[model samples]
Target: MALSTDHFSPSPDAAHLRARLSQAGLRATRQRLVILESLLTLPGHPTAEQVHRQVVRQEPSISLGTVYKALDSFVAAGLTRRVAAAEGTSRRYDADCTEHHHLFCTDTQEIIDYCDPQLDTLIREFFAAKGLQNFQPHSFSLHITGSKLANK
Candidate 1:
């Protein structure tokens, strides 16, 4: 059966991307728009090379170096943040700016977003009760690393 286009809402257009960039304190240049669109459409967290590959398909003139540069700018503007990958691997990027933790599967080297209100509460309480001397914590992520089990 042929699928209808109605159900599939269109991806964020240039105007929306421009607004997002403006809100994030970034200039919405052509390259930045393409790069931002790639980042939003990609699933889970992706590395710089992966993002570059996606963007290049849409705009061949955009170089991997440009993607790297744009990603660094995004990081500086808080539009995106780097997620720690497996030891010795390239750094992964996450567009989600919310405060949350991650579950890293060592076997597959996948990063899964983990959210637990109880855990958040416990950590805040613990820190509130016993804070580091002369050190104030701003944000943190407790990445749990383990192998993903196979399901029967």
Candidate 2:
């Protein structure tokens, strides 16, 4: 499940990114923009260190601490999410903010996006039937853990 670097599509232009950041109440600072660009361009989920490495290529003076801070800001601003890897693995970041599930491969520790309308409906129906008091459902996502089969 080691993804090729080229697997990811290119990110949006700087203007769109700046608008997103601004809408989230975050300033589009150079460090934050560079870090976000790196995250968005990376295939598969990458850890903060990996993001820092990529950002370093563009902004050699950026510090690891700065990257971490920017990631935190991104998460807070709903620009990205912090995904938990398998046990004993470093946390990874995902820039996709859409409603989607995750397929986590235990053997390779790789996470892939999964989308299922039926599953979404089933979950929502089941929960709605419960009719819990003082509880409201905002969203839901499933994390299926298994190994990926090798390609022929």
Candidate 3:
């Protein structure tokens, strides 16, 4: 599906990516492109290891370290967001640069995207009223725990 555009039509993902690379003044290397394309295609958030595995399928010569470097570049370029799962097992990369939250399932290790305007407004208001200083709140994702409790 083609995305609709407004007057302030932000560049398409590919164009934005090229522009980011140019702005960052980094050469558009194949490894970077492959790793980036993989990240863009992958849905939800993914661990560095997961991203490496996926990239390897397409570019066998790419290494895990290279994947990490590419991810760092993307984060630096503001093309992707890095989210640390509450479990701390692995960090997940989010390509969707939109306002949303996450619902994590302990049993299945699932991360679900959540969008609630009421919650967003409340959080913003709460933080604003507190007069937080020297704070750079880039994004917010609520990690709620859920699982079946056993009757001991």
TM-score top scorer: 2
> Which ranges of candidate 3 are over 4 A from the true structure?
1-20, 23-26, 133-139, 148-152
Per-model TM-score on C-alpha atoms: 0.89, 0.90, 0.75
* Tens-digit per-residue lDDT, 55-83, candidate 3: 89989999999999888888887778888
- Candidate 2: residue 107 Cα off by (Å): 1.3
Candidate 1, residue 68: Cα displacement in angstroms equals: 0.9
Cα lDDT tens digits for candidate 2, 1-152:
22222267687699987888899999999888888889988888889999999999999999999998999989998999988885546878888888888888889787888777778899999999999799999987677888989999
Pitting candidate 1 against candidate 3, the one with the higher TM-score is 1
Per-candidate Cα lDDT values, in order, are: 0.83, 0.85, 0.73
Clashing pairs in 3: none
Q: How does candidate 1 score on lDDT?
A: 0.83
Minimal lDDT window, size 10, model 1: 1-10
Q: After aligning candidate 2 to the native by TM-score, how far in Å is the CA of 46 from where it should be?
A: 1.3
**What's the distance in Å from true for residue 83, model 2?**
0.8
Top of the candidates by lDDT: 2
Q: Please list the Cα RMSD from the true structure of every candidate, rounded to 1 decimal place.
A: 6.1, 3.2, 7.1
Residue-pair clashes per candidate: 0, 0, 0
